[model samples]
Target chain A: GESVGLHLPTLSVQEGDNSIINCAYSNSASDYFIWYKQESGKGPQFIIDIRSNMDKRQGQRVTVLLNKTVKHLSLQIAATQPGDSAVYFCAENAGSYIPTFGRGTSLIVHP
Target chain B: EAGVAQSPRYKIIEKRQSVAFWCNPISGHATLYWYQQILGQGPKLLIQFQNNGVVDDSQLPKDRFSAERLKGVDSTLKIQPAKLEDSAVYLCASSLVASGNGGEQFFGPGTRLTVL
Candidate 1:
């Protein structure tokens, strides 16, 4: 079955340090990938996205990298802050308009 | 511009009871979606609507769940005789259309349902 999954259930980082969250998808035909951040008591908010044709994309203090050969994806946060603590989710869109989401990775940033 | 709007930020009901959730999408959006998110999991799509018609409901539990989008703007999801496993957050999202980069969706705060 088609599925998207994360390599870790939780990630912890000190304030001002960098953080990385990883994801993997089973479908190779997936054309688009998105990363979302969900704060406590809030809905998931869009972070960044990368298309299959592109290996990397950056936004603000975050970057998304895609490795099509390994079917892996990663999100990097620079200078992590306490406000960055949230559950992060990765989604894959296989031209279906509806993206499949993976179990989220809880990111805890300590000050 | 306003984002998606959902009513009754939280709901608690007994098992076998019925509950309904309401959603109002962003203005001018043509695509709407409903998703269920468990405590420790990502949001899962339950159904999708393109304008006023249904696009996908394969993951929806038809035996207990029903949804409708009237006039292609607002939507309502109803679950009758709910089960304990049905306790989850119901999220509503909408986009301009179902394809292309413009299809990026904006989500609402969601309604948290708890079945006792």
Candidate 2:
């Protein structure tokens, strides 16, 4: 079965520190990946995305890295803030317009 | 621009009952999607629609869940004879189109369904 998964279920970091979240996909054909931040009582919000053709992409204060060989993806947030505390999800797309999401990683930023 | 809109922010029903959720996507978005988010898990795609036409419903539990988008605008999702396991948050999202790189989706506040 095709699936997207995360390397960590939860991560706690001190405020102002950098945070990294990792994900792995079983399907090598997956070409697009996206990171989403979800707050409690709300819907998931798009953070950033990376196409398979590219190895890295940066947004606001975040960076997404794609390693096609290992079928791995990572998201790095610089200067993590308490506001960054949320459940992070990674989704994979394989030419299909609909992407599949992995189990989210809960990030708790301490003040 | 207004984000996606969902009605009945919270719903409570007994098992074997029926409930319906409504969603109004951003004004001009041509694509709409419905997802189910279980506790401690990520949102799972239930259905995808492209301008009133269903693009995908592979993950939807057809036996009890049904959805439709009419006039290529507002949409509704209905669950008949809801089960206890059906307790979850139902999220609605919309995108500009299926083409190009800017097909980013915007989500609504979602309707939390609690099955008793």
| C-alpha positional error of residue B30 in candidate 2 after TM-score superposition, expressed in Å | 0.2
Chain A agreement with the truth for model 1, given as TM-score: 0.98
Clash count of each predicted structure: 0, 0
Per residue, candidate 1 scores C-alpha lDDT tens digits across A26-49 of 998899999999998888888988
Error of 1 at B86 (Å): 0.3
True-vs-predicted CA distance for residue A106, candidate 1, Å: 0.5
Tens-place lDDT per residue, model 2, A1-111, is 989999899999999999999999998878888999999999999999988999999999999999999999999999999999999999988887778899999999999
lDDT of 1 at B39: 96
Question: How many Å off is the CA of A94 in candidate 2?
Answer: 0.8
User: Candidate 1 chain B, which ten residues in sequence have the lowest lDDT sum?
Assistant: B97-106
Clash pairs detected, candidate 2 = none
- Fnat values, one per model, are 0.53, 0.62
Error of 1 at B108 (Å): 0.6
Q: What lDDT does candidate 2 reach at residue A4?
A: 98
lDDT of 2 by residue, B12-81 (tens): 9999999999999999999999999999888899999999999999999999999999899999999998
